[model samples]
Target: MGKIVGSAIVSHHPGLMQCEDFRRMMGAGQDSDLIAGYERLRHKIEAVKPDVVVIFDSHWFTTGYHLVDGGAHYEGVYTSDEMPWYLYGVPYNYRGHPAFALDIEAVSKEMGGYNRAIAHSGLERQYATLNLIKHLRFELSDTPVVSASSCQNCRPEHFLQSGAVIGEAIRRSDLNVVLLASGALSHRFVDIDWKPNHPRIFHESNLSSPENLASDKKAIALMQDGRHDRILEDWDSDFRKAHWEAFGAHYLQMLGAMGGAECRAKGEPLSAYENARGTGNIHVWFDA
Candidate 1:
């Protein structure tokens, strides 16, 4: 039988792909360490030996229902429509486990999840999904992937319900699954002319502020302590102040899918606190 062998929440910044060149020009080498850290996480993922990856893409904001990518295989030269200058000419090709994705879709509807099928490979790939593939070196392996969209209209309760349904699907399947929640912690973007001297730009809702960083720390602390219920409760007010991506919905899904599996999770901080267009970019892996 299939099971959720592992799960993770990661930042999928577009700059990650071109960090070497981008950071070198700005006289900063922090990105090299960041890249290596992700390399280490990739090794950890390999150790799990997952057969398929179910990615929750924060950028794939579906309007009506939760859209699941159903393509048998995905292949294309990806250029980020949101930030083409950074991600242009990026090539990605990955096989898709359509059968597994279809099962997820069916199971979702059975549990009252507003799940819909999206089977086209040509649809623009979001950075959150593509960047994870890039950083994890997923293309190097043949493990198929399916992407789940973030429902724009989903309430916290409904979204959490949806996550539970997905967990049930994974449990019933015969494929070993790894769940990836793809997004940043804070998401206020810089709206300024970026210069090499002031390489790090700040959003008006500044990310580097002591309060924001402290809140992020608290949030991470909760995750490390396996206090997912606390995150779910505090996300709307306290945690949301830090401007988590999708109001921390991606992380909620990651936690919810654990099925209340009580674990005193040990975590690894994979990336540094960098600025991705004024958003706070960091990767912390909480082992399931």
Candidate 2:
């Protein structure tokens, strides 16, 4: 039976797409740890040698159904509409695991969950998935990738159900998979006018508010301790109030795949927790 060999919660903020010199300049002479964290994450992934990487793309927001990119292959130049200037004209070419995606759909149906696998060549690509591909240098390897979208209309429980479907599908298949939750912690962005006043945009002090910073830190601590149960328990009362990226579905889905509240996978920090325009970003690897 196939199984999840590993998983991670990674940052896909547009700032990471910039050159090292520019990134350092913005960070007051320090490069975003996410830059070096990619290399470290690459080593972790290589050690497991997964056949496919399933990305829970927080940026790819679908309306009613959970969509899976089932294309046989993808190749083209991508430019982010959200931040075109920072992430423009990026070339990407990668194989897709259509069979595995189809399996996820089948399992979803059995579980009465909403899921669809689309192989349309015209489907758009988001930076959440592409950025990781570029940074991890997936082009240098043969591992195929498939991206799953967050259903914007769903609540936390729905995302967890989708993840359970995916987990069951993976277990039924023969592909060793790595799950990547591509999103941020507290996702409140700074107002446009605040940039001039907060020049140190990458620093923790610049996070949206003290509450957001504390919420992110608490969540991170819980993750490190393998206490996802507490995080989920406080989702509505605490973490949700801080407004996690993509409503935090990226993380909930990934956790669901790993056994949800029952999961006790310890997370190791691959990069220091940092700020991205008031949002909480980090690279954390969860041992499977």
Reference-based lDDT, each prediction:
0.73, 0.93
Model 2 Cα shift for residue 102 (angstroms): 0.5
lDDT of 1 by residue, 119-218 (tens): 9746878888888887787899877888888887877776666677778888898878888888877676555764422433322234545566677777
Q: What stretches of model 2 exceed 4 Å from their correct place?
A: 195-200
My TM-score estimates for the predictions, one after another, are 0.89, 0.98
Q: Return the TM-score for candidate 1, rounded to 2 decimals.
A: 0.89
Clashing pairs in 2: none
Candidate 1 ranges with C-alpha deviation above 4 Å: 193-208, 260-266
lDDT of 2 by residue, 104-126 (tens): 99999988999889998788899
